[model samples]
Target chain A: MIPASFDYIAVKTVPEAVAELAKHGDESKLLAGGHSLIPLMKLRLSTPSFVVDIGRVKDLNYIRRTDGHIAFGALTTHHDIEFSDLVKEQLPLLASAASQIGDPQVRNRGTMGGAAAHADPSGDYPTCLLTLDAEFDVVGPNGRRVIKASDFFVGTFTSALQPDEVLTEIRVPAPPAGTRGTYLKFSRRSQDWAIVAVAAQATVKDRKFQEIRIGLTSMGGTPLRASAVEAALRGKSADADTIRKAAEKAAEGTDPPQDLNGSPDYRRHLATVLTRRALEQLTAGR
Target chain B: MRHRVAMTINGTQYEHEVEPRTLLVYYIREQAGLTGTHIGCDTSSCGACTVEMDGHSVKSCTVFAVQADGAQITTIEGLAVGSQLHPLQQAFWDEHGLQCGYCTPGMIMAAKQLLERNPKPTEQEIRLGIEGNLCRCTGYQNIVKAIETAARTMAAQAGKEVKAPAAVS
Candidate 1:
């Protein structure tokens, strides 16, 4: 399907991209790898007048450790994350999420920032990032500011980012020692998007749950952490009974929508099952 | 806007003016006239438009012609020498990997990427590598064999050793 005609401007610098977006407001959209936006444009869901291609801005494609956190340039491709030695070592949960994002071709072109900026509730990164307590570095005409993961996702396919702002970086706090986590997604096919996903990060000391973070994807209007379940599991011994009791609250307060993939009731059931499986895998040294 | 696109395809340089919206598959097939790069699904779902762009396999239909303006591309047509087919192409033919041949061009390109990355891939790795490229025929049994055969052939060729092709039973 041919996308609607639009002006194509390749910007070399962030300032140029910001200026173009600020001048055009809602009419302008920053183009990174175009995996998410182009598909939407082809479907006629997005018809911006100006597509400011910021892919050539080489400075925005980096993965670095800074300020006791890991900062990823929004332009970094999933391929980059899947292959990076640093990511594979220190951030295996994020790396595993990147590895499972899409088929090989989609992974080759899809960028992390593009996915995060699009803020699709069903996307894998948002749920994983929420569990990691990540922050997004937004650059706008006024200046730069950071938005926490909980506040970044406003609703389905929406974010707190203003029209004139571009998400420049994703900052994730370093995992605490003895931290182990896993992201479990259940899909009908290998390349199909997750029907339900659970990202669980846990710190176990003295065989007890020191800290637990549970994030749910495709559960509601946004990727959300299961605070109720976390609170239940906190300070409890890591065992089948405690894990099962905590995971029972996986979808206690969720308002999951019914779709062709599954019904809300089915998804609620899946959340419990997937959360239990994720916790089991993490506890088993997965 | 029209821009001069300079690219090297199959080690040959070509420069042409392409509309900003022209897709890379269109340029490869229409302008460069390499029809081997088929357009099965223009929406990038089918891997029939797969090609090696800048040493990595990508869906040409998903990338604009301008995005590849200064890149190197290798279509299925460039996978062989003057007369000899690439080992992958030969293995596919020998193993009857294709039925209708509609998805062969893409299957070969996707496998090329796999072999380039993992010269000796297991069956599971081969399946994972070409998972993006869909095939409606043969249920992927022969395609898996063809890739495994091609990997061995490629490894042998790299070591300058000639070996008889193994039969896939």
Candidate 2:
């Protein structure tokens, strides 16, 4: 499937990319790994007149530690994140999710920032980033600004990013010590999109849930926080019964879409089951 | 608009003026005239168009030809040196890894990467490694065996111990 003819602009630096976007305005689309955008373009779902290729921007491909966060350059591929020792140690939840995304070839070309900016409700990074409360640094014609994960995702296939802005870096705050996390994705196939997935990060102290955050994928138009479940579990005993009871609230505010993969009710049930499973696994030996 | 794209395919340099939307798979078959890489599914789901771009496996169909500027690409046609077949090709032939031979190039390319990353992979590892490449025939039993055989052959060529397939029943 060939995408519509568009003028291609390859930029070597962030400034150059920003300049091109400013020139083209909304008529341009930034190409990071091209995994998400190319497919949509081929299907004519998106037809940007100009494509700014930022895949070669060397400065925007890194994973480094900052003050209290692990900052990832927007161009860091899922393959890089899945195998990064820093990501594996600091953010196992993100690592696990990245490893499970698409397949080997897809992961080799898909980027973290691309996934987040695409804002697919079933995307793995957004769910994990939302649960981790990650922050994004974006550069535009005006200037640089930071957006929180909570506010970055506006809706399905939408983000808060302006047409002329490029996501430069993703900063995931280092979880407090003793925190354990897991991402449980229940897909029909290993490479398929999640039917309903759960991302959980928990910290237990004295057999009590000190800190618990849950993020649900494909449970709503956007990746949503299981706030009701988190609230129910916070400061509560980290027992199997308590966890199960709290997980029942996983779909409290979600507006899960129905398709051939499952119905809204089926997704709700999966959210609860997967949330419980994730919590149980995270708090197993705590 | 057309874009000037230059890349080294296999061991030869090829340059072409392609549309910005030209997929790498088509560019390889038409521009470079290497038809060994088959296109099973235009979508990224199928690995039939798999190729090694700069030492990593990627679905050529998903990658634009212009995006491969200055990249070093290895296609299935590049696997054989003159009349001698690559270890993967020989292994597939000996193990009957393919039936209709449509998915052979892609499966061999994917397996080449798997063996490069891991010289000796278990049955489960082999299965997981080639998960991207689907074969409707052979039930993947022989494909797994073929990869194991290639791994051993390659390892033995490097003077490493040819361990038996421990996970295969």
Candidate 3:
């Protein structure tokens, strides 16, 4: 699976990486953990003339507490995120999902920024990020800017990022304490991509729904929020009947594509079943 | 274009000017001539090309040699010292852990990491730990036994070190 011949530049700093991208223009690809880009290159799905390796950018591998969020360095590996105590304490939904992506080796080499920027519809982080309301930091010759998770994902294998831009950070706003969140991925094999996945977060105040967010993966071109379901559950009593009703509409507006995993209708059913299960689990932990 | 990639494999440093697309598994096998690390699947699925890179197990096929330019890698070939097999290797032989042996290197490497993290991993943990490595011949019963044996053996060694007689005090 040798990829097409390409030039590789190991960039030591974010500025250097941006400069390389600027130099190569659209021919350049910012290589982070290389788990996503290299596989694409090997399959001939992606062919870039210049691959600026940002794995050597030391400053871009951090997990820190920012003003009102936990900022994950763009190049933070899945293994790090899964094991980081801060992530476990602050965002267990994301940490648990990170633990389920591919295998230990893949998790050791895959980066959050690469996964989000690649925007694989079945990818793990996008679902968690979409539900968690994450923000992506992009830097380029023009300047640095932040893109909300909702607006960042444009379509299948596409993002709002320009070719010359580098995604430098992923900032997840800290959810309130005592929030119950869980990620449910139904896959055929341990390392297989999710056939249908769901991430749910809820905050219960006096046994009533204080906040509710649901994110679905592999349901469409982009990670889709069960907006109707969320609307139904928000501000409602944390009751089984309400959750079941909201989760019944899980597949209402999704356009899932069928692959070898299952049929579209089967996935939709799984989405409904898993959504109910996820909501139940979220509320049960309260 | 080729880039100069120098890495430490099994305590030996090797330098090569490999193409940007050259995978680390090929570099270790062809350039370094350490064929113990097998390449069963070039797509990084089988985990036959697993190797310890900078203290973490990684699928060598997916990692470009240039990406591992300065990393310290450990392959199956490095598991034995002076004809004495590593505990995991010995346990595999004792427990009949392999059938075709194609996935041994990767299985052991993955097991090494698992045991390192959880020395006394339960059977379920052992199965979950080596889920990345696939062995077609063995249904993982014996493989689980081998890891358990190795974990116990390693724990005994650690215990001996901790319980060493205090200087005749």
Pitting candidate 1 against candidate 2, the one with the higher DockQ is: 2
lDDT of 2 by residue, A1-286 (tens): 8888899999999999999999999899999888999989989999999999999988888899999999999999998898887888878899889889998888889999999999999999999999999999999888899999999999989999999899999999998777888899999977899999999988899999998899999998999999999999999999999998999999997899999999999999999999999999998887
> How would the candidate models be sorted by TM-score, starting from the highest?
3, 2, 1
Chain B TM-score against the true chain B, each candidate: 0.91, 0.93, 0.93
Instruction: Give the best candidate by lDDT.
Output: 2
All candidates in order of DockQ, best leading: 2, 3, 1
Candidate DockQ scores, in order: 0.33, 0.48, 0.45
Q: Candidates' lDDT values, in order?
A: 0.86, 0.91, 0.90
State the lDDT of candidate 3 residue by residue for A29-69, as single tens digits: 88888898988999999899998998989888889999989
CA-based DockQ, model 3: 0.45
After superposing candidate 3 on the true structure, give the runs of residues whose Cα lies further than 4 Å from its correct spot: B160-169
Model 2 CA deviation exceeding 4 Å by range: B161-169
Best by TM-score: 3
Chain A TM-scores, per candidate, are 0.97, 0.98, 0.98
Identify the candidate with maximal DockQ.
2
Interface RMSD of 3: 7.0
| Residue-by-residue lDDT tens digits, candidate 2, B58-135 | 999999898999999999989898999999999999998989888888899988877877778889888878888887
Which run of 10 residues does model 2 chain B get worst, by summed lDDT? B160-169
